[model samples]
Target: MTVAPGPADHAELQRQLPGLGQAPGPVDAAVPAAHALLVHPRARQAIVLGGLNIGYELVRVRRRSIGMVVTAEGLSVRAPRWVGLGDIEAALQAKARWLLGKLGEQGERQRRLAAGRIDWVDGACLPYLGETLVLRLDPQQRGLALREAAAGDTPPGRRLLLGLPPQADAVQVRDAVQSWLMKEARRVFLERLAHYAPTLGVQVRRLALSSAQTRWGSASADGSIRLNWRLIHFSLATLDYVVVHELAHLRHMDHSPRFWDVVRDVLPDFDQARAALRDPVLPAFD
Candidate 1:
């Protein structure tokens, strides 16, 4: 986090805003509603952009440039210590369109998270490998298991049965299902690594399952690979894309163009798989 030159202080930042010294407008029925559109309902800071209000959280730190990030929480602005409020506000205004679009995307992502959350009860539906599976209590000694949907049923797919009873709590259900998914992730990742290692002429020594929140997979120079177990929820093509990506890293050790060329040799349609990995809404688990 290096500091760069910016306006003198917060005063300058406020002055730089389009409407600093202007008088306040009258309160009308549309006033609250109109202001609502400009600001995020939960944002900590608000600014006027194109005569519209846009809300974001401003985090000042020792950084080189004013960086903006839009996540599940919302838009966040990071600025250098030396940067004045005016410079930060100006930058935000310049990127208003991108900011608004990202805000909308985060809203959509939040909606999907709500909609996709598993109920963790009998007859609950959960997503499995690009498909939906029904949850049923099968409290036999077998514990947790996935079974094919009954033949000729209306919504033809698979059913996952948990050994727990109908009265089982959410934590019990989530942990049991997660355990099974992780086991499958290890087996499937190993097979994919083995399948691509030979084609890429790279030898991977081990496969480690990762519960990392952000990183999907990483390859070390020592031929060890760590992949997120949540990947089991996605289709095989997405899984293979991550596998090839890490294996390619073994050859180049960096994300240079040549490294991607090696990946292209293995999976030609890598872009689609990459995009697929970025956009899906996974179930919420603590």
Candidate 2:
């Protein structure tokens, strides 16, 4: 004889319960636990728990769209507005393993960088234009100057001399250096923008400094360009590359082959400069 399916068999219970021979009676006892199987239409390989469906989207373009955002408040899943909540949560849970792994890696990298000491005072070694620039404090010099030592230049040696009070604190020193660098950045950036504009057959209508957190530079379709002020920490060559990259955007906004072609036309080996731009140093502040 064949054994009949019980309440433990959820699928079988669901199938058989609806077809019981007796006429429908008033609800007697509550439905058994196994009878509850939630089916979400938008769910793809996602598990359903407590009536909530969770999943992940394979492709997303907007940066604001949340992939896996967890906070003390609760787990929140944001996707394109068109995506259903069930699908969003399901997608998140499906990629939970990968997302946790990436978060751990990022945390570790940040810890390493944080542990690395960054001296912001004079005599500290800092990266500038693909080379290291040693900071020198000279009370005699009246103002900031990028000094290139001559064949027999004296005691201070070859270095960028920053003139400040001997008793100035770190903030004062940092501020003074930044003020000078930004002044130079404005002048130099415009000069470079003008220098490369003609060759690329594009005109730069306006230039501005950007203090954006996530982007190095940006360009408007209307011939306006914005470069990160932090770029002052980089070498002149690297700075020029960024200028060219933004200027090129005047013609091609996307990083498509055509856009890169425009950039390459002006700075042939831009890849090196681009690579150098990724240095993980914070901007100095006074």
Native-referenced Cα lDDT, model 2:
0.61
Q: Point out where model 2 deviates above 4 Å.
A: 1-108, 115-117, 149-158, 283-286
Steric clashes per prediction: 4, 12
Give a tens-digit lDDT track for model 1, residues 5-124: 455544554544444333433323222222123244467788875456667788877655567887766667887677666666767765666666666666666777788787788787
After TM-score superposition, what is the CA distance of residue 60 in candidate 2 from its true location, in Å? 29
What is each predicted model's overall lDDT from 0 to 1?
0.76, 0.61
Over 4 Å off in model 1, which ranges? 1-100
- The candidate maximizing TM-score is 1
Overall local distance difference test of candidate 1: 0.76
**RMSD over all Cα atoms, model 2:** 14.7
Residue pairs whose backbone atoms clash in candidate 1: 13-85, 13-86, 38-53, 139-163
